[model samples]
Each structure stands twice: as structure tokens, then as C-alpha cells.
Target: MAQETDAPQAPPSAPTAPARALLPLILPAVVVGVTASLVFVGVSVAAERLQQVLWGPLPDALGVGRYSVLWMFAMLTATGLAVGLVVWKAPGHAGADPATFGLNSPVMAPAVVPGLVLATGLMLAGGPSLGPENPVIAVNVGLAAWLGARLLPRTPGALWPVLAESATIGALFGTPVAAALVISEALAGRPMRGRLWDNVFAPLAAGACGAMTTTLVAHPAFDLGLPPMSHHPHAKDLLTALVISSAAALLGMGAVHAFPYVHAAFRRLRHPMLMIPAGGVVLGALGALGGRLTLFKGLSEVGELARRPEGWSAGQFAAMAVVKLTALLVAASCGFRGGRIFPAVFIGTAVGLCAHALVPAVHPAVGVATGVLGMLLAITRQAWVSLFTAAVLVASPSVLALLCIASLPAWLLVTGRAQMQLREDGTPVR
Candidate 1:
């Protein structure tokens, strides 16, 4: 079925040594990092202001009491409609669908940036259960790639995507190390002419700069204010972590299994205008049932759950976890532009808190970490990144060993299982 070429084939260009390729990228990498951080800060600021308007003054003006379930429903519906409009009208189809793409998808064309930003801003302000990680990464990568082409035109084309993704990850997590782990894991087992670290050098520089800049500007906080595990770990703690982490992985897998069916259902609706607002209605109902704490991407909400585990009963925590998971499924499946990782983390926190409540002997910090590790492993299917996130977020250096031990059981549970990502054909792609 293939046609043969009649003309002579062009010879491949000579490869540049890794060191020579990286040398000119040093300054350009820094500039890209700074740009990505500033862009993220701007988006965050805008979303915060929108949140205030929707949750604060708008409610007062409308005379709806704070925390009114009806207001939550209305706002989410409006948000869905707003996003539907953007998706309907945006250039380049507003880039790739999040369901069909990974964190490191090719950079989108520059024309799609406006629609992407607006849809993401609306989703965040409207209190979708998804987070800014996916959309923001796309935005930064597209912009960074475009800029890098102009300023460093001679840089290897492959390196531009790496720089953009590195900067975005660093900005998102506020850590160069997170970017390093992610990139290293992504590149593992791939055939390369040079050492893996050699290719990573430029991206790492960009990531470090991005992390520093975002920290200085946004002060993005990941630590949950739980009491540290100051005492030495007991054998019982290891047992507790294994049980909790495995259980959490199983819980996360339940959502993963349901993902393809739910995504198909949404796609069956066949139009963004019909599908997105309907999804929003469902999210609003879930919020009404689960309360304000269950709304939004679970960044601050997860921390709140950890900080005040005593405030919720086991049944209440269970409800929050389930509702949050359902919301994530609906938002991601029904054309929302965001990442599932943050909401999954929130669900894990709720599950862990519930486990701790049931068995009072386990330390809350350990419970939370194991739960995070398991859920992240199941959802992302990346062990190193999950392990790093579990250890880093707790901010307790002493528990790293315990978390490392905890992750093995979770990995066993999740290995060769379903993944959360979908293929271009609208089916889950594990």
C-alpha cells in the first residue's frame, strides 16, 4: 500500500554534541523560565479575583446567604456555558482536549492561547473540581516555544518542548526537583544518542529558574499543617502505611475503571454546548450534597481536610471523597480543560483521614502520606513522581523512609492496571 519515493532522499543533518547544544541554551532557558513563572502568576491572580467575585460580592448582592447550595449550582452552570462558548468559538479548537493528551503533549499553536486561557480561568473561578496544571502547562509551553523560536532559532527543535514543559512543571509545583523527577521518568527507556542527564541539563536550568521565580512571586504552598512524626517509626507504622496505601490505590482504581465509560457518555452528547453545562449541573448537585468544601480543585481543600480531620465524621469524609472523585470524572470527561491530579490528591486526603478516624493508633501524617502516595500512583501511574509528591507535601523529612516503604504495596496494587488518560478516539488508553 505504500508508494516508493522517486527522488533522492535527503541526508540526515549531522548531530550536535550534547554539550555544544546545551551551551547556547543557557540564557534562553532562563528567559523561558522567567516568562513561564510570570504568566502563571498572572493567571493565578486573575482566577483569585474571579473567585472573590463569585463567592463573595456576587452572593451578597444577590442576597443569597454564603454557602448557599443554590448559588453553587447557578455559578457552575454559568461557568459551563462560558467555557462551552470558548470551546465552540476558539481558534485551533482551543488546543488538544485534556482527556486525549498528557502533560507533555506537543506545544499548541499560539493562536489557541486566548481561548485556552479564558476557558481555564472560567473553570477555576467557577469552582470546577479540576486544577490549573494541564491547561496552564499547555499555555506556557505554547508561549515558551514560540518565544524560544524567535530568540534562539538555532536551538534544537526537540529542546524547545523540553524547556517549556520543564518550566511549566517547576512553576506548577514550585520545585525544580519535581520537574527533574518527572522528566527523568518520562525519558526512561527511550533510545537516545547521549546520556539522559545531558539532554536534561537545559530543562533543569529552566525548571530551577521557574521554581525560584514562582516561589518569589506566588509562594505556592504544598505543606499540610499536620503534626510532624517526631518520634522514631514503629513496625506498626509500616504496617499501617501498607494497609492504607494499598486501600487508597484500590479506591483510586475504582475511578480509573469508570473513566472510559464516563468519557464515552460525555462524548455521546456530541456537542460542547450540551455536554459541558450538563456536566456542570452534575457537579453543582454534588457540591450541594458534599458542601462547599467539596467544590473547586482540592488544593486548599485537601489541606483543610488534613488540618481539621476531627471536624468530620468517617461517613462525612467518605462522602467528600466520593463526591470529589465523581466531580473529577465528570469535569475531565465533559470537555473541561484541567488536570485530575490535584483533585485525586484531595480525595486521597479525605480517604486517609477517614482511615485514621477509624483506627486511632495511626498517625495522621502517615495516614495522609500513604493515602496520597497510593492515589497518585494509581492515577498518574508514575512511581517516582508519586513518591516524591507524597514525601514532599508532608514536609516531614523523617517520614520519607516510611513513605518509601509504603509505596511498594501501592505500586504492587496499581501495576499493569488502567490509566486515567484517554486516547484520541475517546477511549481510555491504558
Candidate 2:
């Protein structure tokens, strides 16, 4: 992917800094990385435990199927109300409306961290079709920045957000490479004093530590367990990849365009309490229509879908894709605190399965990887992250060439278009 030329380029004669100045940062980076990963794991585990009680024992005790449409509706509605209460009464209004932020948003106030974490936990446990990435990143960044400034007063204030952001990303993806790619794209077109590696050194160390910590604690895995594509890429595979990825991009763009309007509609409600419960009702209807498979952030559901692709027909997969996309749109538009990336991956997985079901000749791995590449590119508008994520999900080097080629048209479709994020006034973030 080509870097954006929106900022001035660095001079060729930019001087390199000595090792002494750079090496001192490594210790702080490691500390930040490990701390960030622990926070990520802590929040996720708490959410998981809450989910078990809400969906498991409570439903069973009531003699109702946990996935029954009515139960799903009630849980979602209740979750919304609970989150609304927190936002209304808790500090920082859950760290600004989630609709107004993106993956790499500004550092939040320390007081906002508790509310944000609480709201995020509710959304995750309540099956909001969103991921932990956004709020968790906010929490980590806020904490890191505040603490770093006080404890290391001599260090640059800007450094904490960078290290914390990289560390959180590394923890989220379970790889420092993801942090490197995301940060690299974020740094595109900006002029800096040192070489690229010099700028990235501390962040890279933080990312490495974060990824290692998550690996040791959570044992996260990105691969969907799909059968590998053993054959070398041919001309037909390239064409297939292009078509699938382009189609997926178009689908994701539909959601992006709809974001502002959806957000505006919810805004008319005039309060988080009203807006959120109403959103919950709509999400319940969607869950009822799409079934249990379409709820939550979608990582585990996508894995289930991958494990038995033949169990569902093309129509089913297509329905799942649409339902999940709509759920994402609704959840995000109605003030839910979470990220779109994980649910987008689920949509991509469903789209890929649908493609394979319709055309048996298309390899599942190729379809999945390209589908993810397109969706992530369109949704996140971060090329390196999109490419890295799609590549990792399949764990196939052979698919990398196809993803690279397919991303071109997909990127073009979304490049200058409105993003999934909204401005403070509910306009698309461009």
C-alpha cells in the first residue's frame, strides 16, 4: 500500500541519535507493555465470567434457552440500561461518546478510565456485536500517559501514548508485528527527527513485551482453523481474490456510509438511557432474526463457522453477514463502547463462507483472507493493519500475494470515502 502524502516528508540529511539516548527508553517501554497486556487480559476475563452467568446459569435456572429471542432481547435491553446508568452517573460519561472516537483516539482523562472500562465490560458481556479494542486502548493510553508524566517527568509526554497504543495493539492481536504495522501506517507522511527504526525502537520493544505477555496469559489465536491452500496461485486465483475482496469492500462501504445517519437517528433520542435501550431493542430483533451465531464480538463465532463451513448454506452465510453488519451498525450508532474490527472479521468470514458455498472451486482460505482484507481495509482504513490481520487469520504465506493484489481495488474504493468513525457532530470522520 502507498503511504499518504498529506504531511511534509523528512529531510534526507536528518541526523541519527546516539544509542545511549534510545536505550534508556527500553526499560520504560517494557514496563508499559507488560502493564498494558495485564489490563487487557483482566478486562477480557472479567467480561467472560459475566457472560457465563448471564447466558449460562441465569437462563438455565429460568428454564429458558439462553439464545431464545425473548431472552436475548431482554439481556440486551438490560445491558443498555445498565450502561446508560453508568454513563449518566459515572465519571467522564464513559470517556466521550464511543461514536466520536476511533481505534487511535486522543488520550482520555484518568477519571474517565473507570467509566469507560465499566461501559466496555457491559457491552462485551451483553452481546453488543463489538470488540474490546477501542475502550481498552483508551484505558491503557489514559493510564499510561498520566502515570508516565508523573513518574518520569523528564521523559517526553508524547512518548507514553505511543508506547501504550503499541502495547495495547500488540496485546489485542497477540503479535508485535501488528503493532509495528499499525504504528507504521499511523506515522505515514509525518516528518520526524530520526530514521524510521529509531522512532519505532521504544514502541517496538513495548509491543514485543505486550505480545509476549498476552501470549503467556491468554494464549490468543487468530487462525480460524480453515484448511490451507497448498496449491500455488494461478491467474484464476488472482481474479477470484480481486472480485471477492472488491465485493466485500463494497459491502463494508455501505455500512460506513450509513454510519452518520444511524448515529444521527440515535442522537435524536437526546439521552444515553433512551438511545441505548432502544438500540438494544433493535439489536434484539436482529439477534432474533440472525440467531445466536450473529451476536457478540464474533471471534469465537467465526471460529465455529470456519470449523464446519458445510453446515451452513450460502444463503445462511449471507444472512449472517448482513445481520452481523447491521448489528455492528446499530451497536456503534447507539453509543455502544467497543471497536468494529473484530465484528468486521466475523462479517468477512461469513462473506467468505458464502462465496465458497456458492462456488466450490474457490478455495476457502483464499476467500476468507481476501474477504478479511477487503473488510478491514474498508472499515479501519489502515492498510498495514488490514493486510497484517487478514494474513494472520489464515496463517498462509501463499495467500499474501493474493491479498496484496486484491487490496489495490478495495483500497481505491474506500481511500477518500467516509470512515466508520464519526465527528462530534455525528458527521463521518474523513
lDDT of 2 by residue, 182-293 (tens): 8877777677767778889899999999999999999999998899988999998899999999999999999999989999999999999999888988998999999999
Q: What is the lDDT of residue 282 in candidate 2?
A: 91
Candidate 2 has an lDDT of 0.91
Query: Candidate 2, residue 239: CA error in Å?
Result: 0.9
lDDT of 1 by residue, 297-373 (tens): 88888887877878888888888888988899889889988887788889888888888888888888898888989
Highest-scoring model, lDDT = 2
* Segments in model 2 whose C-alpha atoms lie over 4 Å from true places: 1-12
Clashes of each: 0, 0
Q: Candidate 1: lDDT over CA atoms?
A: 0.85
Tell me the deviation in Å of residue 17 in model 1.
6.5
